[model samples]
Target: MGLGRLSALDPKEPVRRYQRERPGELLHLDIKRLARFEGVGHRITGNRRGASQGLGYDFLHVAIDDATRLVRPQDRRSHAMAGLVQPAPAAC
Candidate 1:
């Protein structure tokens, strides 16, 4: 079998890109979880004593507009409540 025959065995799909004509036409939402800590950690304090325990996490909510490329980011305390929060007015 030749090298060309091997590549022809598995065909790949072409990549597609979509763009919105208006600012509010499309929006992408994302959530990121960040660790919560109190005071300085061992990296900064050089001591692991008095470490905080049971500290929860903070959720970062981000929204991006497809056309205008505008981004809105918000810090939330709970993931459950993150979805309940309302979106801010568009600056455009």
Candidate 2:
């Protein structure tokens, strides 16, 4: 369908809107690794000689509400969440 026809149904509405009924109804969680070491790293200089062998990395833990887009970020030494606990929600 054309955009003109689509917009007519819900003017100024997003293409997709997640309906969150409650505080914990919908949430998003993710983990990402941010390189902690600085130097002529592996990718650019290549790992043929194990250039980044001793270098370590830090992990970024992130959470967000699908409804409000409120984000919480924390950095950790490791990415393993085996014993990690969920943080209490902040006051609205």
lDDT of 2: 0.61
Q: Local error of candidate 1 at 9, Å?
A: 10
* Each prediction's whole-model lDDT (CA): 0.72, 0.61
lDDT of 2 by residue, 9-53 (tens): 775756984567655456677888876665776677767575545
Worst 10 residues of 1 by lDDT: 80-89
Q: Please report the candidate that would top TM-score against the real structure.
A: 1
Candidate 2 — which pairs collide?
none
Cα-based lDDT at residue 54, candidate 2: 53
User: Candidate 1 on 29-90: residue-level lDDT in tens?
Assistant: 88899888888789998998888998988778887878878787776654443343335225
The 10-residue segment with the lowest total lDDT in model 2? 83-92
Off by over 4 Å in 2: 1-14, 39-53, 78-85
